[model samples]
Target: MRRLRCPYCGAVFEVPKGAVYAVCPYCGTTVVAKTGEEATRQYYYPPRLDDGEAFLLAVSRARMLPGAPADIAETASLARSELHYLPLYICSAEAWVEGCEGAREEREETWLATSRLPLPGLEHGYRFPVVGREPYDPRRARRGVFHQPDASPEPRCSALRARVEYRAAGEARLAGCRGSVESRAGLVGVAHYPVWLIEYHHPLAGQPLRAVVDAVDANLLYLEYPIPLERRALVLGGAALVLGTGLAAAAAVGLAAGSLAASILGGLVGSAVAASPLLATGLSRTGRYRYRPPRVERLFIKG
Candidate 1:
């Protein structure tokens, strides 16, 4: 047993010799008796939306997007929702890359590539414009009732992120140089980002559409779009009608010229021209779906 003296009250107490940290029993003062690398603190931003509000927000978003079925927000029921803290690699380092000219190393260019980590299958594909955010200490996270995601990034994911970081550094260094460049990463650490996962079923889409929302500001980051049955049917019918017309015209022309092969070729061309409408529609829909503005871009439904 070792006697520990309270710095605040000067009260002496006995604690296990192996204990690294303990609280003073008399004055409720914290004491640290160990030395080494300090542990990194995890944090979680308080979510504005609870279970109910999150569901409503998702529905409202659904209603605004074009091509979304009318009353989908109201009619579509939420099947499942998840709130989790996604880990990110917050790197603060500089790369010393070698800038080469022709076949020789020209000079050393120190390039700062990027710090934000990637959350694949999530917003911006990679973390973009990840600035200005306040986080609460995870140890005191019980200030509000919110779910914490238990899933963590595996070791392989860390390796992938490191590769991305190095590649980005190399590309940046090369871009600044004329011929070639070499890059290496430095300081990096693990961080956490909070997100809301909402899964709901709508009539238009046979499967559920998953929407990933930013828990802090309630912004929709990534949404899986689905095409309705009616649209699919229309696209198919329209394409078939045009193709059939093209084939018939080609066949007729070929028969008149006494060449069976010519007729087949003409039919193919006719079908393509007929299907132009479908192509145009598809392109238009694709452009709209990629629109990122929450207010301006009404809907982003993808089939």
Candidate 2:
């Protein structure tokens, strides 16, 4: 085993022979065992939420769901709450195409979260505002689980380099010249982002529903909430009313026009149109619980 000290926290840990990376158990910093200059440093974002605050936010988000019980915020029981630090790799690359006349330069950046766990709503295009990032510290984690990076950052950095080179080549082509690319990956860093996994239960939902929130920004990422009986009844009643009214209107028109065919066609059209919305609603809220965010937006740290 090779022993390596974490650059950010100075915690010494051992990695298997020929291993590339290992996360420091003390500070949760992913340290590279080799490739000194090419390796990226690791940092973490401090969590802005506490246990009580995270649970309250989850309850509030649940109450905001469509057809949610009015008393859910008051009556829901907090079952479990867990804090986790997920790893995200930030890779940047810049390329310059050397042409006969001039050179064209292009840059590319990408953020990739490399957790194999079943975390929902954590995908590419989710931007992390590069602010308030400090050196990884276990004390600041507040007893949260520091999930190790499941994948390496090299592939992502390579992809970024390819993108930069492609863009540079395109620019050279537009300038009426073919060129060769000179590209290098830059600023390869891993950031451990804080997340809250909250579970709550209400009598209406039978089972506990989970909510994932960004601890730094308090933005709800994923949510599962119970559907209120009142809303379900209202939807059913409205559908019935619309169906009956349309059938009556169709029958009246048929009687006025003295044509059964027109009545049948009108009724069919009316039924299809009226049922479409209701069917969609029902399908979306198929079970007692629904998984969706009320007002979703990009979650990032305050600059």
Candidate 3:
């Protein structure tokens, strides 16, 4: 490994041997090590939330969940709060197609860079900031842990160009009759995005609950809260009551109608109709309670 000073920020950082691109941690500048050396502008999203604000938001979210204890927001303790800066590469492409009818130009499309720890939200339609990003400052660097990219930017940049070109060409072809298409990849740069990993304790839960929040927008990406026992028991008790009443109604209907089919139909309808509310509540509570998968839980807390 060798260390080099960033011409723009004057921050000295290390790069692996034979690496084609190195991103400056302090300034978000990328240095190209190709024949004609070059530098690309990069930016980092500033975090709008602090640990206290994030914890409050988490508690608010937890309290809003169905079957959550009413006082969870007040009683919950903030166990941990960490800010993380995830890296991304931004790439764009422009394509034009010419056909017998006319020529059309497809709008420029962009592909954001991905990393090993891009996290779940990025892949599941979580849009990263395309605007309102600020240039990295030394003071900002001290705010959180700026994760280093696992791989050089060259590979991701290349992949981005390829992906954009292919997608643009495909869209152009689909828009009109197959024609000659010209596509060119545009600027590729690096960015560090901010996120918050928060862990909190609730008396209802066995362990600390984890929440992933977007530091840029102060939005919750992921959260987990336990269902209050009283709520669950109340729902179950209502269900039982409805079920018993339905059974009695079924017997009455059968005795009045004097038919087995009528009795069965009455029983099924009564049970379903009377218990619909409780049944729905139970299903919803159980489903939401079971929503936290161990893998995802570990990813946010342990990863």
Candidate 4:
């Protein structure tokens, strides 16, 4: 037996074993029922840590310069974090459409449709499969409370329907397969993923830096760092020295023999000087950082 909550009347009801669909006695809404086997086989992600603490851990590791800021440390220490389980929906369907191309007067028109026909007596069908899994592991605990599913199933299903509509309009053969509208294939469900959030103290300044990563995926999400005014000046001065020295050498060579070697040497020096700023800019944009428990491992759900 399984318990069901009515979407229309908010009534609760007990569904008999093996029942697929049940009609709400009070509100007349058709609710799909899950089987005992299906209910027991679903996999869930366990919550590891609260959002605020996770954020702090991440930021601490995202190396800020020495003597950064006091405010940065305060902000990192006072932030909040949240945990959630999002849902992902999947579907398989047949699509048909009509389209046209060319000029209006002598336009070419075509009607195209493909169907698997569902094997005569087979009715419309839907199946939800477990694709990728994200588990929360705050302390590397062997057991923990799994986060409840929070994402609505309807929107996910609607996206899938839109994809089917779009596919039907395109010039392609519809084969037997499962698909999603905006997400990657083989990702049928978007279950809630875990993440660690961190705020780190900047020693020089009074401000803190923010960082986030997928606890399960170990994918870094955000990072921010500032470059010192002195470093910027140093880069500019170095570039000027490289350019001026090269130009002076080239002039000397021209006065001596007007040789190709002088031109080649000048060009190389000029290119290096011109490219220095770009390299420095790239480095400044990507600030220094590190993470603990660094290996990324994919989680798979068997149920």
Q: Name the regions of candidate 1 deviating beyond 4 angstroms.
A: 1-38, 41-53, 63-67, 95-120, 142-185, 201-209, 217-229, 235-303
Between which residue pairs do clashes occur in model 2? none
Ranking by TM-score: 2, 3, 1, 4
Question: Distance (Å) between predicted and true CA of 20, model 2?
Answer: 4.0
Best by TM-score: 2
- Tens digits of lDDT, candidate 4, 85-189: 322223333344332221011111111001222111112221112334333222332222123232334444455555655654442223333333232222132
Q: Write the per-residue lDDT of candidate 1 for residues 97-124, one digit (tens) a residue.
A: 3443322211111111212322223423
Error of 2 at 282 (Å): 4.4
How many steric clashes does model 2 contain? 0
Q: Per-model C-alpha lDDT, please?
A: 0.49, 0.68, 0.64, 0.41
lDDT of 2: 0.68
Worst 10 residues of 2 by lDDT: 284-293
Count of clashing pairs, candidate 1: 4
As for lDDT, the candidate ahead, 2 or 3, is: 2
How does model 2 score by TM-score? 0.65
Better of 2 and 3 by TM-score: 2
Give a tens-digit lDDT track for model 2, residues 52-108. 788888777766554566677898888998888777766677788765345455554
TM-score of every model versus the real structure: 0.42, 0.65, 0.59, 0.33
Models sorted by lDDT, best on top: 2, 3, 1, 4
